[model samples]
Structures are given as structure tokens and as C-alpha cells.
Target: MSGYEKTVLLTGATGFIGGRLLLRLLDQGIKVRCLVRSAKKFEAMFPGLDGVEVMEGDPARGSGLSEAMQGVEVAYYLIHSMGSARQKGRGFIEQDRKAAENFRIAGEKAGIERVIYLSGLGEHQKELSKHLSSRQEVGKILASGSIRTTELRAGVIIGSGGAGFEIIRYLVERLPLMIAPMWVNTRCQPIAVSNVMDYLLGCLTTPETAGRILEICGPEVLSYRELILCYANIRRLKRAILSVPVLTPKLSAYWVQLITPVPNGVVRPLIEGLKNEVVCRDNSIRELIPVELIPMKEAICTALTEVEKGPGGIPSRQSCFLHSLT
Candidate 1:
């Protein structure tokens, strides 16, 4: 590989967005080193892949991160603890802070040039949900170090297999008659998973994105209710969503836990985070990376296709698997 070619380190390579991003990078012939908690899981998720290195590490544990950063040019911090039990105690934030600090120190020692982070879209330094606030704080921590950082803030990503999309899918597929919280009216500008991948890959080629924060979203902005209605339309399902203002975040989270199989730990943060509008506040990323953003319906269709593919397939549609809401 040329010197200009980035030897990238990717955290959360086994995750939904990370998996897609990894495939894109590999297709581009970019060298990649993935930090995974389990080598077996990594191999199972990405079997028979070439031109990639899988290093054993858990970012939350500060383990194996140093080795993963060795000789890496760019590192993508994509790890989150929404699914973990520790999230109940708001431990994800501390874990993320530690991970960011560790990665920064390790990357600095390894001479890494840049760190690219995918974070949630929300107001910074405010009363944001623990999840969103932690994401924002992690970006700040990464930028404070010697390695310059690029933070891409985005709303719920509409892609197959991603948690947010799964929630949308479950609500639409399982609940023909839906009782939703008032947050359903909260606005969001969701980007298709493909467009997000495009922008992430664009970061690899564009040197200008380093040390900057880019807010990204699709061309259309819609309410969470509208998103669900649109998804229902794509699936050709007749759905009715009744938003009840009395459903507190806690109650909504419990409902999600019971109905969607999403654990309370995960559902709570997502529910709380939903209280804030997540539309794109800036268009700097578009100026930097020009790709035709796909429409929401097309994005939903693509995600659904991946979901229908099931395991051992190319995720033909985004995974719509709901966590056991039991």
C-alpha cells in the first residue's frame, strides 16, 4: 500500500454500522485493523476476508487497544455501550471517556494521524441524554489528544441491522396499532446506511475532514411518527400510531422493553435521547463529500432487503431483529 493509503484501526467492527463500513473499506483496498472483544466473533462476523487484521481488544476495557493502534494512520471510534447492563448506571459515559482517552494515548504513541468518530446529533454541553452526551464527550476527549479528530454527528441511521432501524422495524412490523410517546413527534433527519458509508469512506480520501465536526443527514427530515408511517407504507402494511403525551420516557422505555425485546438499558437511553430533535444542523459535510443522498423510502427498502437475507447471507435487508422484549 502507498504511504498515503491509510492503515485504519476500527472499533466496533462486529457491529451493524461498523460491519458495513468495514466491508466498504475492504472493498476499497484500504488496510484495516479491527479491535474486537472476541476473535471468534470477529471471524464469524467476517469470515474469509482478506486485507484486514483483527486484534483482540475491548475498547471499554482498555484492553488490546494499544496493539490495535500500532502503525495505524486513522482510527474509527464506533463503540457504544447501549446494550450493556452498565448503561443502567450511566456507566457507558465513563467507559467511553476511558476508552477515548486510552485510544488517544495509544494512537499518539503509535503516531496515528487522525481519529474519525461517529457520534449522535444533539446539542453539546447541555442536558442531553446520557447516551448522546457520552458520545459528544467522547469526541471532545479524542480531539483533546495529539491525534487530530473528525467527529461526524448524525441522527438515527436508517439502515438494516442497526439498533435504531430495528426499533422502527419492530414497531412497524409487530404493532399494527401502536401506542407511542409524545417523542414520536420529535423531528429527525435520518441518513441511509449507504450514504453514511459513503461519507465515512469519503473521509478516507479527503484530508480536509480531519480535526473537524461534520453534521450529516439525508435530504428529507421527518418526525419519528412519519418515519414509522413511511416504513409501514414501504412494507405495504396499514399501521396506526397513537401518540400519548402521558407516556413518560421511563414508561415508554418499559413499553419498548416489553414490546420490542430491546433491553431496558438500551431502550431507556434511546427513549430519553429521542426527546431531542435530531435533524442536521449544518451542511458542511455535504460540501466536503458530495454523494447523492438516497430517499428515505429507498433506504428503508434496502434495509429491509438486508433484514430478509438473515444470517450467513449478505444481509439482503437491514437486520430488523428486535431484541427479546420479554
Candidate 2:
């Protein structure tokens, strides 16, 4: 590689977004180093993976980060503790905090140029859920470092194998009728995985994106109920939902776990987030990156066939999503 060529460090390279981002960066012939806990597991998960260096380290534990940050021009902090903060207790929050602190220290010492972080989209002034609040906290910790940081705050990313997408798919496909929580009426801006990918890559090449917290989302803003109905329409499945005032977050999670394959632990935090109106307040990023924001209907249709099975260790129910409807 030329001396001027950029080398990137991708944390959380094995996740739904990070895995696909890895392939995209590789396709562009970029020099990439992925920080993984076990090289053996990484190799097994991404068989025949090439053109990228694998560094065995756990970001959560703040291990091997200094070496990973070496010679890296930019780094992607895609790491997030996805477990429920309230249900799982303080462990998840602490993990996220430690990782961010370590990463900031490492990147600054190593003279990294930019850090791109995918953070949850929720207004800080509002009473944010534990999940969204934790994400925002991570973003703050990263930005405090000397390195320029670009935080992309996104709401429900509609994609196959993604936890958010999987939940919607199960709720719409399995249940023809749902007496859902009042949060179902909450407004959110959902983006397609492709659009999210484009924006992330755009931030890498676009210098102006550095040190900016941009809200990246689809062109359309939709309510949770409309999003479900949109999925049902695409599948040609008959689904009905009644917005009920009775279901608490815990109860909603239990109901979801009962019908969907998603575990109660994962379901609770997500359900808690549903109460917040996560619609994008800022649209300035569109001018900066200029990506075509896919509509709700088109995004859902494309995601239905994006992946049947989970790749890079993220759980998926897409394989059985259609089967259960019949």
C-alpha cells in the first residue's frame, strides 16, 4: 500500500452493520484492521476473509486497542452494548463506558484522524430510555477525545438480521392482530441498511463530516404502527393492531417474547425505547453526504430478501419469518 493510503480500524466488525461495512470497505480496496476478541472465531465466522488484518482484542475490556489504533487514519466505533441496561443491570452501561474511554485514549495517543460512531437517535432534552441514553453517553465520551469524531444518530434501521427489523417482522407476520402498547403510535424515522452504509462510507471520504453529529435517516418519517402495516402490506399478510393503553414496557416485552423468537432481555430495552419519539430533528447531513433515502415501503421490501440467515454472529429470524405466517 502507498504511504498516503488510509488504514481504518473497525471495532464491532462482526455486527450486522459492521459486517456489511467490512465488505464494503474491502470492496473499495481499503486497508482495514478489525478488532475482534478471538482471531480463531473471527476467521471461522468470516471464512476466506481477505485483504484485512485481524487483531485479537476485546474493546469492551480495553485490551489490545493501542496496537489496533496504530497506523489507523480513521476508526469506526460501531460497538454498543445491546443488552437491556435496566433488565441486565449496570454491567452493560459500565462496559460501554469503559470501551469508549479506552478507545478515546488509544486513538488520541495513536494520532487517529477521525472516529465514526453510530449512535441512537433520541433528543437529549426528552426523557430518553436507558438504551438510547447509554448510546448518547457513548457518543459524548468519544467526542471528548482529541480526535475528530462524527456521530451518526439513527433510529430504527430496517434491515434483515437487525434486532429492530426482526422484532417488527415477527410482530407483523406472526400475529394477524396485536393489542400493542401506546408507544406503537410514537413517531420515528427509519432508515434502510443500505442508506446507513452509504452515509457511513460517505463520512469516511467526506472531510466536512468530521466532528459533526449528524442525524441520518430515511426520507419518510413513520409511526411504529404504520411501519408494521407497511411490512404487512409488502408480505401481503393480513395484520391488524389496536393501540392499547394497558401494556407496560415489561409486559410488552413478555408479550413479544411469547410470540417472537426474540429473548425477553433484548425485547424489554427496545420496547422501552418505543415510548420516545425518535424522529430526526435535523436534516443537514443530507447536504453533506447526499444519499438517496429509501422510502418505508421500498426499504421494507428490500430488507425482506437482504439476508435469510444472520451473518457475522448477529441473530436472525428471517429464515423462519415467512414460514410462520402460513
Candidate 3:
């Protein structure tokens, strides 16, 4: 990894995917500056981790970003929020818009060379939910800047700490007989978190990856019910799902929040997004950065194993799992 480039600015390093990416970047001997809301909190999480510079910043408010973005080569935008729905179920879209604008301005001023953003995958022609639209909008804003940007649009991510997997975990484990909404039949392509990590890490050294919009996903397309049953089969839990037309997305969100550790603010928006069939529209990423895409059953098994490890798991509880669908 010698002769590598200069420092890279990483946002959302405290979250599930970002935290893991932090570890990967450090392992590769990349110089990293993390833009976080709290320096103390970041240090507390990683303890004695070296080679990382922590700066306090809120991109939405444009605080501390001018300094954070200064002299950085590339940046990772992983700051998708489920908590943004804290006010009247319509806050996240506006918050995301503002944050992207702020980041674009800061990066442009700082002369950042590139930005790699992970966005939600869905056809724009299909009336996208608020969640998916917000995700894509952020990508658009970031790319609108002078800095070249690579946006990887992903569907349902299958991992322990991810909202999509955790919701499925709780639902299948707790309910032997389940009552669900019609969205349960909606098909989605579920990619393993490991495969996601591979693609992300690959983007770092692959200069050709810059300024591209790559749609990433797993090998199989299955309904939400199939995902549930796959988890059940993996865990040896007997489960049954009856898809009724009655339960609205809001009701389903409440029911899920009651069972899983995921909050209602996050669950509501994620549930609304489930209605859209999310599969990779483009497969260009496979040739750009090749990695063995893990199967749904294996992804389920790995996630369960990580959860069994408690605080020492691969995706630590401290890392934010604020993914929209995955």
C-alpha cells in the first residue's frame, strides 16, 4: 500500500458501514480524517486507534467542515439518517438536501478530488418513496459539485446491525405466526455486508471508479417473505407469514419498532420504502471491482453469528446502523 495518495476525509465513521470502513482504511495504511459531531465520542469508541484525525462538524449546519475538508484527497458520504424523521415524518428529506448542499460547498472550497457516496437503488421512473428519493437526491447534490463523485446505489443490505436484517431477524424469531402487509411480497436483491465492504474498499485504489454511478446488489431476487423464511431456515425457527392487505406501512413500522431495537422514526420510513422492488439496474460494478457475492442464507448465518458475539461483534453496537433499507 506504499506510494498511496494523501489523507481522505470520511463522514459517518461512527455508523455500522462507516465504522467497518474506517477499520478497512486504517488497515490499508490510509491517512484518514473523520468528520464527526463529537471527538470524545469517536475516541471513546476506538480507544487507541492511531493515524485518524477527528474533527467536530455537522455538515447540515455547515459547522467545522471548512477545516475538516481542507487538504483531503477523497471523501466518503455515508451519512444517511433514519433519525431525521424525528419531526412530523417529513424531516429527513429536507435535512438530507441541506447536508448534501453543505458538503458540496465545503468540498469544492477545499479542492477535494473525489467523493464516493452510497445511495439507495431504485428506478427513478418508478414513483420512489420519500426515503429512496432522498438518498438519490443527496448523490445528485454531491455530484453537482466540481469534485468528481462515484455513487454506488445498493438495495437491501443483509447484515447483523443493518436495519433491514435486524427487522427481519426480530420478526422471524419472535413471531411463529405473522400477520404482514402486502409489501411482504415485494421482491428485493439482498447483498451481504461483507460484499459491500469489498466493493467500497475496492473503490479506494481504483481510480477508474471515480465519477460513476454503479448499482450494486446480490445474486438472487426474492420477496420479503422469502427473506424472512430464509432467516428462519438458517436459525431453525419455524415461522409463517400471512400477507394481509390491511396493515399499512405505518402500522407495520410500529409493530416492528415494538419488537426490534430499531426506533420508530427509522422503521417508519424504511417500511414505506419496502413497497418498491429494489434490484440492481446496472451491473457495471461487478467488472469494476469483483468480489464473491455472498448468498442470502450465508449472509443470514454470518449476521446471526456476529450478533451472537455481543459487544465484540464485527459490526459493533456502537457503530450506527442508519441504513435506509439495508
Candidate 4:
């Protein structure tokens, strides 16, 4: 399977990370087939892009997936169940498990050679949050099939329109004085969205990534509290953060709902997940990809610029800003 000759089937093509990867692949003359739920919505977002194919399907239902996997050399599984809470009930873990099983069966039936999955970084299964646990479980389900699986576990993705960045940005911009939960003190390693895309694209060509569970992150590590302060300083806003130890996840979610635009479902999982420190434990991926990571300040600046640009989308030259920094 040569890099230039592979036909990659990408799920979650309209998502924050997936959308960026799709454009990069297309630009490199890689054949990309996207599995999207709504063709109309996909067309609305993409609006006449050449050299890409879209197949209408739902990964959750296992419908229309087989057709999309046909003749696929490598399939990128970027779909997550966070936004599907209402439709799948409050326990998203079970929903994720079922979806992964379906995807595995479909991939095997279609003879998919490799399956690349993007997941979250967390401790061992016993100490994992429901969200992080579900991500790991999904990786296992994908590997159960004969197809080789590459699981890239990442922490908060720093990019405009990304849920993590949105939360950090809104908190910094909206509050002059904040009463944050103790989880804010937990350490996290964030990777720029462009860096994430770089690893994803690298997996397509790097056979060493197959059958490996790799953790990816930026050059620096900081506490969630420090991240908020950094963002505040970037925008030149005066702010004071007070971390309260007694605030439970439930209480924190409610407070976030009141203070920010983040919904309860999204905020709840995020808050629960933030209690654990999320720094990379190994540098194996660095050896594999061999690209210098973007600094935190530069990543935040690029994210802010994208948000201010009205989500009309980032220009191609701007898409790989972090790549040049590397």
C-alpha cells in the first residue's frame, strides 16, 4: 500500500479536525471518500469541492457504511458520540461501543486494510473518565477486527470552533473574575488542530503507526488555570481566577451553563474528564512524525484569528501555520 495510491475513507469529515484533514488530503491528490450523515448538510458546508466523494451514511446505525468502505485502503475513524447524547441516552459509553462494533464489522466485510482512530489521553481504564473510557473501548472494538488499528490519543485540541478551545476562550473573554472548580488546577497537554492533522496525515504514510497506541501533544504542558490566564493575556483582558475545591462536577456544569454558551451535556463530560491530569507519557509519536510542535501562545493566536474571521473557514496557507513553526 503505497502512500500515493491509497484510497482513504474518512468519517467525521465535517468535524473540526476531520474537515481540516480532508482538505489536506485532497490538496495532496489523495483519493478521499467521506461518510456523512446528510449529503445536503455536507454539500452546504463544503459547497463544490473537487476530487472528493461524499457517501450519505450514519456510523451509529451501521447504515450506508459498507458502501463507503468499499475499495478503501485506509479508513480514518474520527467520529465521536458526545453530540449524540440526546439520541443515544445519557450513557454515551454504550452508544460508542455499539457504533465501534458496527464500524468494525462493516470494515471487515469491505476488506479495509487499516483503521486510524483519534481518541483522548487519559489514565489506565480503571481511572478513566466515562468519556475517556469510551474512547479507549472504541479503540479496542476497532482492533477486534482483522484490520490494523492506529489509535492516536490526544488531549484538548487547540483550534477555533473546537469545543475545548471554545470553552477556554469564552471563559477568558466573558469573565473578569471567575470562580472555577479545582479541576482547573489539573495539568493538560494541548495540541494545535494543525498538529493533530499532521499526525493523522502522517499515519496514512507511516506504517510504523499501525497497531500502536500513541499519545500526541504540543511542546509545552500547562494547567487549565494557566491556560485561561494565557488566553486572557493574549486578548489583553484583566482577570482573576479563584479555584474552589468543593465544586462538584454537577455543580460546575450548571455554573458553566449559566455563565457560558456550553451546554450541560458537553460541559458535564468535559468537567468530569478535567479532574485528571492529561499530559503525554511517551514521546514515541514525536520520533515517528518528527515535526517540532507549535508553542501554546502561537496556537492560541491562530485559533483566535480563525474565530474572528467568522468561521468562513481558514485559508489553505493558514491551515498549516503550525507546520511551518515546526
Candidate 5:
């Protein structure tokens, strides 16, 4: 199928994963319309990009959704409220739910062919953490819509600008000896950003992926403590972690804030979620999308390499296209 033949609507274009996916779609020559709250900002980000357009809209506020979804074939739902969860209090949950419902209605009304959503991986039990629960709930809401939905539940996404990776980066780069909570022992399957994007793009062409709840994760499963140690090792920094039961989630968040670029609000729920074992429960996505998955160490190395190049490491879509031409 020709890229021009496929029309895709993308949400969270300003976010880490969405931003990368935007470039990928443009590179593949796919027509993309971004649902952004500020068209000015979006335009500023991709001034001369071709085969792409921006629709001014807000998903959380439930405005401009219908107009944004008009005539789109596939919609990528990457919006989440975790960033504003603390500021919104418990109301963030309701905000996320509302946004999902609005997107569902808009997509259904627009007759979208497929909706691809990136969600978190966790046990479907009452004991799931609030953050994980919200992720899963959004998946459910999107799946309930008239269109077929492909919800990819991922663990910690290792990337340059990702929140989870930032937390790991700061903790390792700043501290040599860490007083960690017991949750540090919790195991998670971390996938590289490139691999995640491949799976996401693969979903667009893989008709069998629709209406499926797929788990995309790294080949290696390691504890949070192990990941931190791995990060330290890659930097050639000797580190030791003393896992203790005394540090509460709030205290851990404050400690993280002191060391990391992340704020206390965003880190709190993330820290709390470390207790849940988030390794992949299923791996059927491998056969569907045969991209070679990056290992934890290699993923960390790539992320660090990009980070070392400064904020401009990740190129804008227009810049990428220009570079390709050169």
C-alpha cells in the first residue's frame, strides 16, 4: 500500500513516543494530522514538514476531537494524564476517562479503521497500582469504541526523553550509593523506544493485530535494582543499592526529585508502581512484528549516546526529511 493512501491521526504529538512516531510516519510518506492543543507550537516544531498537518485541539478538555478525527483512517491514541495527575489530584483519573471516551466517540463517528493505543502492562487484578489501572482503563475505553483497537501494553520504555528512563538516568548519574525501597526488587521487561515504534508502525499494516491486547517488551527481564546497576555499569560507575523497607513512596518521590529532573508529583506514582511485576505476560507480538528487539544494555547505551548529544539529539521531522535527502 502506498503511504499516501493511508491517512493517520496522531494524538500526543508533543510527547516523547508520539514525537518519534510522527517522524517515522512522515518518513514512510504517510499522511499525518496531529491533534495538538496549540497549532502554533506544532507548526513551530515542524515548520517545513510535508505530508503532515496539525489540528488545534485538546483531548482532556474534550474539544475539537470530532473535527480532528474527520476522515482519518487510523488514529494513534497516546494521550495520558499521569503528567498532570498530581496537579489534578484524583480528578486526573476522571480526566483520562473523559479523554478516552471523547476520542472513542470522535473516532467512531469519523469511521476510523483502527485505533492504536500505548498502555502499561500489569496484572488485571484489584491490587493493580493506580497508574497501571488508569492505563488499562484507557485501553478498555478505546477498545469499547466502534473501531477495532490495538492496545500495546508496555513496561518501562527506555528512551532519551522518556520519564521512566529519565528517572533511571538521574538516579544512576547522581548517586553512587542508593537507599532504595523494597520495590526495587520488582521485575520489569523494558523495551527500547525504537522497538516500540516498530511494533506500533507494524500494527498499522498487521491486520491481525487489531482488537488485540499485545504486550511488547524487551527480551531480558530484570529487577529495578538490576536496571539501576546496569545503568551505573554502562557509565563505568561503581554503585551499591541497599534495599530497605523504611522509605515510603512519598519519601522516595522526594528523594528522586532531589536527584532527578522529574518532579515529585510525577515520580510519586511511578515509584509506587515499582512494586508491581510488569514483565511481559505474553509475546505474540514478536511473530506479528519481527523487528530485532534491543537488549537492556544496548538500549541504555543508545539512549545515553543521544542524551550526551544534548536536547537536539532527536531531530525534528523536517530536519530528518532534509537529512534523508542529503
Candidate 6:
């Protein structure tokens, strides 16, 4: 039903954001080719979804990228090295750099037109966590490539099955009272997963957004403690957080691992990232691609509603009514 239809290559089709984006692209009747590590897994996930071609490959390994990117007009780079860095003992910074380089080289060789990347929202002036730093660095590497690139950065994405949101949900639901690190005082602008998908899909039609780093977030800005308390309120639970300066990042990560389903490696980097304030600096993207941004409470409600329906039952952006920015 939308006008912008072209051959697109999605790198992280199996990821949380990428999966949602893939559904929207299909809803718009766009032809998409996905580069995934396993075609069988992708097929199993989507079942009978038509009009999507899956190519087996790993961007981190630099395998099957060119073949997957052939004739692709727009390529969405949503791949990250967080899990590999944390679990496999690989340097996340180096892994991300290598992946971006591989993607850049492949895109240039294939003559791809545009690159859309989702990164973290953090101020460059302040010291950032390795996870956030690596995200920004990947965006830079992708932009430096031959193809035009549009980078969208967000903070604390709240959605069902999302690591950040799940971590928060687990912490609040499992613990009525918590001893948190000082970083709990750090401020962040959380965004809804559906709104993030809207921005990603809208970028395809809006040409001016190319070569720009757009910071997309929810309308409200709240501290980490406030976010947790808000979630507690929504669940009608009395939660109290005691923030202490003595708790180091490592100790906080260990605490998180014990309290939630999040792994130690994953929570360490994520906990470290909370040290810096990650609020939006430039909101110009609001004017460029205007979509109704969901508030934090509504976003949490949506995520919780999806969780009530099991993981497979979680709806995509295409199934829900989305406002058109074009």
C-alpha cells in the first residue's frame, strides 16, 4: 500500500528489531532478501510467510554477504557483536569493527544504494560503556563505507523479548526491594519497539534522512530508578531501590545475574552502559519523520500484554495499526 517498494537486504532479519522491520517491509509489499545464519531457522520462525528470500550467511564471519546483497537497493544493518563479545570471550569492539568492515566492503562491491543502521543513543563527550561505544563505532564504520548510510540511535528500547526491557521486567517482578548501583540515577530516554520500527520503515521513503545520525526516543526522560518504579507501579507492586556508591559495575552485574534471567556476560556490559546518561540530544528527526511516539507506560503495557500471549504470539508492527509518516 506504500509507494516505496524496492529490493532490500536485511542483515539481522532474525533479531528483535529486524524481525519487526521485516514484517513492516512485507506489509508494504516490498521485496526483501534476508541474510541469516540459518535458512532453516529463519523458515521455521516465519513459517508460511511469502515474498521473503533467506540467504544463509554470517556478517561477522564475512561469509555469503555479496551473494546475499546482489541487486539489493537498500540494506538494513542491524547486526551486533554483544553476545559474541560477552559469551565467547571475543572483543566486542574488534568484532563489531570487523563485521562493519565486512558489510561495508560487501555493500560497496554490490553497489548497494543506502545503509540503515540502529545504534545506541549516548553523548560523545562523556565516557560511555563498551557496549554503547561499540554501537556508535559500528555506525561510524558503516557510514564511512562507499554507500550512503542512515544511522538511528535509541536508548533503553522497551519491548517484549528485548534484552533491555526483559532485564528490567525481570528485576522488578522478581525483587520487590533492590540494592542498585549509583548508575541507577543515570537518565535515559526509552522508546517503544513499535515506534522504533516505524522510524526504520519511514527512513526508506524519506531521502533526506540519509547520512544523518537520528536519535529516536520516547517523549519522557526518566532515571533508571524511576523507570523501575514505573514498571513496579504498572504491575501494582511496591518496589524500593537503594542506590549505593560502593557497588561496582562487576558487583552490580553479579547481582543482576542472580536476580534476573540475564546472563553474567550480557548484564555486565549492559550494567556498565548505565553509567552514562543516554538521553536524546537532537530531536530534529521528530520533524523529518513524524510518528506518534508511545509513552513509557503504554509501551510497558504493550510489552506486558505481548508477554501474556507467549513469545510466538507477540504481534509485529504490521499486524497493529501504525501511523504513516509519509
Instruction: Encode model 4's per-residue lDDT on 1-326: one tens digit a residue.
Output: 23577679999888888888899898878999999988887898899988889999887788998899988879999988775644546467777788899999999989998999999998783487888888989999999879899999999999987888888877777779989888889999999998998899898899999999999999889999898888777676789999888888888778777766766667778878988788999989998988768888889888877786765432332433443333
Number of backbone collisions per candidate? 17, 0, 3, 0, 0, 0
TM-score rank order: 6, 4, 3, 5, 1, 2
What C-alpha lDDT values do all the predictions have?
0.82, 0.83, 0.84, 0.84, 0.84, 0.86
lDDT of 6 by residue, 110-139 (tens): 999899999998889988889999999999
Give the better candidate number (5 or 6) by TM-score: 6
Tens digits of lDDT, candidate 3, 17-117: 88888888888888889998878879888999988999999887789889998888789999976674323444878888988999999899988889998
Worst lDDT window (10 residues) for model 4?
Answer: 314-323
What local lDDT score does residue 316 receive in model 3, on the 0 to 100 scale?
Answer: 35
Compare candidates 1 and 6 on TM-score and give the better one.
Answer: 6
CA RMSD of each candidate after superposition: 4.9, 4.3, 5.0, 3.8, 5.5, 4.6
What is the C-alpha local distance difference test score of candidate 1?
A: 0.82
> For model 2, what is the error of residue 200's alpha carbon versus the real structure, in angstroms, after optimal superposition?
0.4
Candidate 5 weakest lDDT stretch, 10 residues: 317-326
For every model shown, what is its TM-score relative to the native structure?
0.91, 0.90, 0.92, 0.92, 0.91, 0.93
Pairs of colliding residues, candidate 3: 15-320, 16-320, 157-326
Error of 1 at 259 (Å): 1.8
Better-scoring candidate (lDDT), 1 or 5: 5
TM-score of 5: 0.91
The deviation in Å at residue 289 for candidate 3 is: 0.9
Compared with the true structure, model 4 gives a TM-score of 0.92
Question: Candidate 3, after superposition: displacement of residue 15 in Å?
Answer: 0.6
lDDT of 5 at 245: 94
Candidate 2 error regions (>4 Å): 1-4, 84-90, 308-326
